[model samples]
Target chain A: MGQRLIARRQSLKYLGMLAGSVAGREFLAAWLPKSEKAEPIRPTESSYTPLFFEPEEFSAVEALTELIIPTDQSPGAKQAQVARYIDFLVSAASEYNPALQHEWTDGLQLLDRLSREKYQRSFHEISAREKQMLLEEMSLPEQDSGRTHPGYKFYRLLKEMTVEGFYTSQVGLIQVLEYKGLSALSEFPGCTHPEHQS
Target chain B: MGTHAAYDVIVVGSGAAGGIAAYVLTMKGLKVLCLEAGRMLDPSRDFFTHKFPYEWPYRGEGKPGQYGKLPQGMEWKIKEWTDHLYTIPAEDPYALAPGSKFTWTRLRAVGGRTNLWGRGCDRFGPLDFKPKSLQDGWGEDWPISYEDVEPYYDRVEQLIGVSGSSEEVYNTPSGKHLLPAFNPRCGEVLIRKGAVKLGIKVTPKPLAVLSRIYDNRPPCHYCGACNWGCDVGARYSSLDVLVPKLSRQKNFELRTNAPVHTILMDRSTGKARGVTYIDTRNGLEYEAYGKAVVLAASLVESIRILMNSRDREYPSGLANSSGTMGHYLMEHVAFNSIEGFFPQLAGRPTSNDDGPGESCLYIPRYNYGEKDRKYLRGWRFDFYTGCGMGPGPGARFPGFGSAYKKKIKELYPAAVQMGGYGEGLPFYWNYVEIDPGGLRDRFEIPQVRFHTTSEYDHAFAIRDEMYGQMEEILKASGAEIFPYEKESPYPLGSVTHEAGGCRMGNDSRTSVLDEWNRCHDVKNVLVVDAGCFVSHPEKQITHTIMALAYRASHHLAEEFRRGDV
Candidate 1:
């Protein structure tokens, strides 16, 4: 699986440079190291245990995060272990920022309450289609006022945290986004594109 | 009381001004004793610039309650990664008026703010010295001219290894830079192209970072973490560049962690005897004597020392004869930034774009020579590429998952931002005074109370003009402007370019220091810091501070030769 991923990344880099995209060339320069390939370690769904959430709560958070950034052509939030990262963040927040800890607890409780009211079951047990419909309804603000639904505000927070957790993770940044920086370069490569010139 | 041996000169604060003063004075064969309030920091162990976020406990974003614990005025100074470089406000506190909001961003370390300064080493033009002459009713003109300080400016630039091409911009005077200029990235090129259409000249910014190996210091490795503290001696910090050189000289002696309480004065001759300071480690008071004293202890701190020094002859303060010890506190007021995405550079492959944080292009003050605006002085603009490292602002990117990831890559390289820094007129109302009701620090020394106010009409007018020009350039480049509300000018000291409080002029009643930066009342005492600045120009002040220190120290050496000091 690791070899296949590396091969795919190399091909994508080649195709990007051939098409004259600076982003693709940057990926090649940053990722194509001369040393042995060091594959990033990611926690499997089975191996991970929740520190902040209960088993049921963890299941709901995992389901919600995965749905928010579901696996398509590339690895998604589940592979990046965004739920576990969020659990770790919330667990640590209990000390300095108790308000942040309270926000997470209340937000999770709101999700549970909404899921039980609509489907008579927990959020993880709800059907994917039903989950999507419920999320769409939660996303919109009230008709009379500009304020959004409490559940929708929770969704926005969760989504923002999930995006941050995923993009910063090795799997997301290297494999998905292909970020290439923090290396010592002899010189910087300025813009070479003629189209960008006036 | 004087247990220590007498030295030729005693320099306070070992930052930019003090560093230059010590070097110049000692090199002239005068015995100098330098006292610093902060401990020395070893960059190799202290700097966390290259550390990855994952390696840190909270991913380099402070711990949950960490920010809440920071004191009100100090929260902006301490970033999660750079917290070690700043002083904890709870431990070292200052007072402010009830409704006033002033951000006194300070570092109590040996190198001071220079260790983590934005290395924008710009030279002040001829108009900066004579602001009253430029337009009436601004402020008093500087006693010295650009011609008087030009030679010292060139000497300091070469010693510090400034990198830039010479663009003959009138306000940003040219210098004999030591290194080649950095080439502009795609985003900067676009900015230049758009600015040309508006008849604005954008040239390479003169920075204090070395482009090539010079004077045994290595060139910048393009780490892009200049503010985090450079581990290698590539960037110019007094600790790295000046202190080590001064340490080699036999006449120079540096004492760290010795916070000066007051300047000891001789009552009979009215000359500065030396200084009495507390040992920060053991809390024991010690006095050091010298023939002459140079106050290079930053702007506010120097004024604090002077104000605290009260004798039978001068009850108010040591230099209160002019009554201008702590007045005319000025800071550069920065306006909101104009940021946008250049569509043409979208989806371009990324490379190691990590260079110094200094902008590749600098738009000098063009409002001068053609004064049609309501405001008196003008502003300058700086252009740079990249939205910075790490995960992008997820809140801006709507939606989640794979599609959002695609958008992040597309928008990453296209990021371009331009920030405006305008000149703030020095007002007498904005000043720092020792609290009359006895508010003192841990050392029992009285704390300073700041009362600062800006010219609202002039500030707002400059902001509107700058924002309008920025929008025109962004629109001309065919870039999508970010959705941001226009903001009011930042509060005083927000830019960390604080000046004045002890200004220089010909008149003794109006100014504290003379043209050569010597205190008017005391012949042997001199202030060679931002406090000597007559008018606060839009340009950065570190280069000028160092240049003035060298010029004043040279003058002091001449006086010593003639036995006038």
Candidate 2:
């Protein structure tokens, strides 16, 4: 019984270390019950047209941003319209910093190349399991600062834009995170918890 | 130019000093004309205090290339919200010397930087007046004392509507006109509890906020947007608190967009009888004459005006009889900052914790009377532990995907920030002068150039010690310390609390201004701003500037009654 408890504690420590990455999610899947993976939510068509990316490139960007901040318990990047925000940001960059626009275009093509090289499919045509694995592979160089591979650079840029676009949206800021600032109050009631007072 | 030649007094720059001079002088029934370098801001249109990130066109991140609008030497932080107050580069051009590194945060408008100030109204103690008498004897003592300025401080506080606790804190005077200070936030209480173990007293910051319905203004509703311009008259900006009432005085007149070019000197009397200024709207130069002229166009700008007013009688600069018009420049040492969070409060339910920004909690200078310290002057801390739960931390956090989002949500109410602001000894070499290269602004005025340094090792040592103590206090509260810069890496003028150019002295041979903030050389000219500050204190100086302006204007009023001018 002592030996089993020691082994369980070791596994728990490893689980905590890799819990946020793809590695621990797979580990948990083997033991814990597998949850349902719903169909990916696509943003509703509107009057908005892609200013920077082409029609097919926009679809791939939309798929990736939604994947980065997937809908689990609340609305994700799809509902936040993160892909449209990126297009707006990059398109506006065309006037002053054209290199920024080039980087986004090159980054999307690199992701497509990585998807085709590994899974024999385009980035938007990949399976959900294959997509997650590709993302996991692309993010390997991000863990090490010295590695400046093309895949790492592309993944970093896309992930950053995705985070910025999603978190600043009303759906993410107010509904998901429920930000507590930018409101009026008659009086501020500070830490009411007795244990926190010390 | 209506009644321009018949004014009793001409006050330049409608900011803290000029606003007070106009208010007090007009109350004394003197004809006062206030010349503002910038346009009159409509608070309903210009202020964006309650604006949300989603409401902003750029989502509060600022547009991609919009930062290029700020002039060289201007602060980058102003480009987002308060950029309208700062001057554009080519229009109001000022040069930085080849090796000099400074960020002069100049603001023009009826209210000046008061519209975007921290509003921490700390009064200098009795010791602050006689700094030269201290242990190391590094700087000169002010000709005026705390006793001489105490009554004026009281009046200014009452007039501006300050709110803070009346505490018997050392080396600090308890305010006589302060309203009730706000209740301590949770982070403040926790930090105070932690500081108790270290023998440091964390007190509620005395702020220029109306805590109650005082002087017909409604109380502050705690929006935590003080830096973004207070639209409601709850927070004290000179525009909201002083300008409206002063304008109602029949003896007063205000001219906006009228940037003063120089002090029009009377060669025979050797006194300033009028001012030459340019009206920005019509692009015309006009002369407005008065019995007396008050140079309250901020500290550096006042020096620029006096320097530009040079003639054959006093070629060095207009009141350069003592040769110290723009010498001892000092800014508060403020690069020592530590961001941390209490572990016990992590994952807790978030609340609207941003009660009063910048005026939350302060660890007052604890080394008031200590002689055994390694540093000459002491430092203080400004800590704000608001629940700034936003996308900002998520961007800074490592990783992405569902887990990253979950972590950000969990650590929502756990962020805290503490920074130390301390005194930097005035080195004689640090100064501001007219650019010898002869670059001029759009109005054909010689541009002011700055020369200063921040590589003061002794001052930086104190900044490092401040960071260490902050870590100790937070660790005592079971808080986790985030990574931060240990060394003092900020430039000299990062604080923008520049003081000391025309030093006030009892003697005329060593200083430009007399004890009453009047020019020792020119009898009718008064430099009534921080330009006459003898030494820079660790605390901010806007409160002191207002008080000194009040004292000087009252003394000028008495002289007017006596027919001395």
Candidate 3:
């Protein structure tokens, strides 16, 4: 029965290959549409016109993103091209709910203003220590300060987006975590494996 | 229209539920009509070959600020571009009281939501079929037991070719599966190790996607094109397998783009005579006759269809004489869970080789058995190690130059992640009611008023516990935990495993459908979907929904032979 099944599968494969051969490249193209390709959101140039934010706002946004997902041994937020993705996402973000846009814009402006008051410097220019302190302070409850920081809302969006984008990325998912998908020779490493027990 | 095409069975909606129903009933030599609302998709052309979000006009992400096609907003958008066409818009006046948000995401296309589902298939154990007995005064027990539904589940596992291990089956029931089950990648192995150290039962998640060559379908290719649609036909979507076979049967006639208006019931006996539908193309109205009618148009749409068939017997609507047509709605309460970064698995190159099922691992419900909890029922966690590269949000990262690409390449496969996918128990107060005077959907019918779980504390508390448990497991796994900032909860109907509008029970007065999934007031009409679930299981909702469809279709076919209807 196994032999018969194998023979049947071989025949099916032969038939499939023959059909493919008969239906050449042009046939395949007409028959099957092409996949949509992922394009780089940022321009190739180092200094390009800011689409979503002014230079000042962009600098503050950069600092805020870094705080949410800091760089470690393997490049973190600064290296991921996430800022470009955000720029593209925001510039093209005319169709979103009003609450989301308001939250994001308000949050960024608030964070930058607070940074200027505390450090007498732009948010991006603040020391990493100062940045961390500011983040921690903003994360605190409003009852303690009697004023809720605008940067807190920006932090929320940055944190959520960072996790979502980072985890879904090819780099973050594969190189970092080692997720191996469908393997033809995939073996079931039973939880009871003595190695696992150890 | 012509001879009033007769059939032994008529299964509507060519989804996980309707497809299985057609395959089972037709294999028994019963003539079946499987009607779907969307176009028949050609897998080679329509599926994974080119399904990047970037491929669509919106790139799978809709316009910057536009409310998506369903009008519920873009955050809750279903995968397909056509999903925009099939789903009901939010502005259609689907009534919900203030602060009571309902996220009704239904796919009316050929394969339904199974095409873009999470591929997590689990058995709803005996505890789920009878939740009322376990807790009290919340919902009804299923007419069928876990034992009664056990054989059907086994048959389904065999037919769909599931990849799972029976040993991992704890409170989440298991069946005779195709293979032992695929294992977690190295990162998942570590997370599982940590979770187990915390006394959490982390096991291999059972997925509907093929691990090995089962039946005729190919094994998963590990392309991770599952959220869009798998063109290779490895995933468990009805279009890939069941509906295609059913279409080959001479008696089956599937009509796509046929938006069903109402189930035309006889005035004298309240029997389902036929269905009146409008062809979405020309806006022409046509009726198809069947000895029996099955409403498999999903939970939300099915409720809408029944509510539209207004008659004297069912003054509220057909099969709704009991005033329970659209009530006790339940949705799996979900959120983007606690995440953490671990440096242990860094430096590995990207491995985008696995399909949807291959990404990670599953931690079974460890809170079961003699455990005192803040909530009655329990929830499970899905763990996956992140690999591969994609752009991050600007708010989260920096750099627009080649430096960014170089960095992304370096960090592609080094992130380990886990999420808690919990089930919400049915609360009678959390239900769907129809607004007769509300503005209609695209179908021009009064929209369903959803008053389901919004302020339910038990469900919320259960979610909080899930967050705590997830953090414990991550800490055990030796990772720096990134805790959930807040309970960023999504609205009901967002999880897409939306169930429990027309719950099945022995009590005819309270429930719309009986144990066999037959409508109590209208014997000839069978309602099968997530809506028929007595209680939402700890696992995902597709397998149970498919199994219930089969059971109901089989019973309906048997009744047709017996001339019972």
Candidate 4:
């Protein structure tokens, strides 16, 4: 993945020179799973009723969201109640955009079919390792140019919602991200660092 | 009070120009009736200022299943906030020609676009009025000069309270009564290295935000919600600054939802007698008489009114004998931006970078005096930093997981996007007219067919050249420029700094209005809005719009007092 990223950056002429010189270039870093906030996420329970999804589909969706942005030190999407939020959103918006309901139903149903074909079990019924592997398999075609894979497309859509739901929630924004905005500051302390100036 | 009241002057559209015109005219002891098509906006009630994304019902993307263009970006693909600020497209429809690329966003509030404006207060210099004359002479020049509107500029800055530093620049002149300027941020300070290397100045932007106390209005607390409407009345919105003062004046009266249909003309006198307007709430049309009529109904709307006001006396629309109405349409070329982040600021503790809710740095038009040029007119640079706005920078990053989340946290505060904007040369074919066969809105006013004949091949060439210079500025500052697919200016009419539908010039044969914004064909009619702008300088033009309207209103007042009409 790291080599592919470097090759892709180098392929673009404008990025060719920077790839060799800058050690701070993100592609040079290790592709290992080691990350900050590596502790397990204690996801808060939400008694949210699924609006669009059936009980089985909702459980599978909840699992997928957690896998995409799992809790480490802070709470994850499960704690943010993102799947329920998405289900409610799709159901409410069905009147205006009927295609959305079809997209979600079909996407989740495809996830079930793919899991059953691969492992002879539903997505939620699969092992934790099997779930991650299946998701990564869906994610692989995302980097490929021009080929719009439906499984990869669904993964991208799911990831977008998970990221949006997590980052916008109080658990994601204040608890984890430590956002410091919308405050009345008497004075804005701008660029006092000596190294940053010259 | 009677529904029909006789007025000394009738003003249309209460945004930047109409706001100033109402204040000036009413204060001049004239009974001014300001007609705003939009309903009143309550800042405290309507404004979604300082609101968290999670606080709203659907987390600021509006109600579930509502599909609209995400005001910014592709993903998270809905209104994250300030969606209610704009006029609904279905409610206010306009036509776009077959291949025309124009995205018109209108603010439905009383103050119009100023409620959510960036609050840039850049004053036009002496050379700006003669945009074409000073250069190789390709376009038209303003009927009025910077000298003719200098005192009005001084008056506007005094009333509005712009905070900026004197860089001693030529194009962006310093206002006489400016409040103290804000200190440059880490991103702004870092980018100056590239600007200095390129022999250009990056000065603190002249903004209408009050830095210190002025006119009993409190100074800006730097909450960074200017685009979402300022709730504290710190920034200069027409609702905050102009309407409050206008409310006190006994001669002033604001009639909301009264959209002006046409300028009612008396065939005998050969002058604008009054205007017929529809009261939106009642579905009834009424006539309001005035000694003089001020058409400050924005650039497109004011021109639409004149074009719709056809009669036996003046068939080619009122005051349009030259057939030059709706010609010479102009919009400032903007939206080509480079998303970048300072690698140095990565992994740093997050601090609030929303300094008064707008970019403080400005690379004013330096190529105005230069001999060589990339395109027709020069482009200026300004940056907007959206620090601590949640995972937006991470969208560009490949892959997702705990590592992705960690990377987003590290880079969230380091994000900054700088854009280049330039002067748009007036094209005669690029104009807005009453839609030949378009739907009328609820108010029964005919929709406008917005048209722009710009291929943007020249615009792309300008941006491509600008990218090289802007890239150098970013690269020198150790900022990683994010590669974006958007390589040209935003579709024309997207940048709300849209001006010029009825051009003002010395000759009535080629222009619509005279130097004082009064129509040459009809003496009593005046266009005090940006509709009268002959050409735009290489900067954000709302400040110049306010100054021109103030000067024009004063001229109208003088003319009215002298019984010139």
Best by TM-score: 4
Model 1, position B38, has a per-residue lDDT of 88
Question: Ten residues in a row with the worst lDDT in model 1 chain B?
Answer: B392-401
Scored on chain A only, each candidate's TM-score is: 0.71, 0.74, 0.61, 0.75
Residues B1-565 of candidate 4 have per-residue lDDT tens digits of 2333388899998989999998889988999999998899888788877888788777776664464443312112115455666765555677877776665667655888788776888888777788678766778778778789889989999888899987788656887558888877788888886678778888888889988888999988877766677888889988899898989988999999888999988777787878989888898998898878999888788888898898876787889998889877777666546766777887788777767766677788787555556577677888755465566454445455677677777777777667777777788888887788866887778888877744455566667767777778888778877655554566666666677878898899999999989899998888988889888666778888899899989988887788786
User: Tell me, what's the RMSD of every candidate?
Assistant: 7.9, 7.2, 12.4, 5.1
lDDT of 4 by residue, A1-198 (tens): 001001111122222122222331343232223433323323324466677788778877887888777877667778788887788777877767777688788899888888999999988688776877777778654333333455876786687777777777888878777777777887776678788778
Compose the digit string of candidate 1's lDDT tens values, residues B340-421.
5677766777544456556667788887654567776888887656534544322244344445555666666666666778
As a whole number from 0 to 100, the lDDT of residue B213 in candidate 3 is 79
Give the per-residue lDDT digits (tens) of candidate 2, residues B117-189. 7788899888888888853586789998999999999999999999888887887786865898887677777
Error of 2 at A187 (Å): 2.8
Q: Provide the lowest-lDDT 10-residue window in model 4 chain A.
A: A1-10
Interface Cα RMSD, each model: 13.4, 12.6, 19.1, 9.1
Return the DockQ of model 3. Answer: 0.09
Better of 1 and 2 by lDDT: 2
Name the best candidate (by lDDT).
2
Q: Model 1: which residue pairs collide? A: A22-B348, A22-B349, A23-B348, A23-B349, A23-B350, A24-B349, A26-B350, A96-B65
Cα deviation of B223 in candidate 1 (Å)?
Answer: 1.2
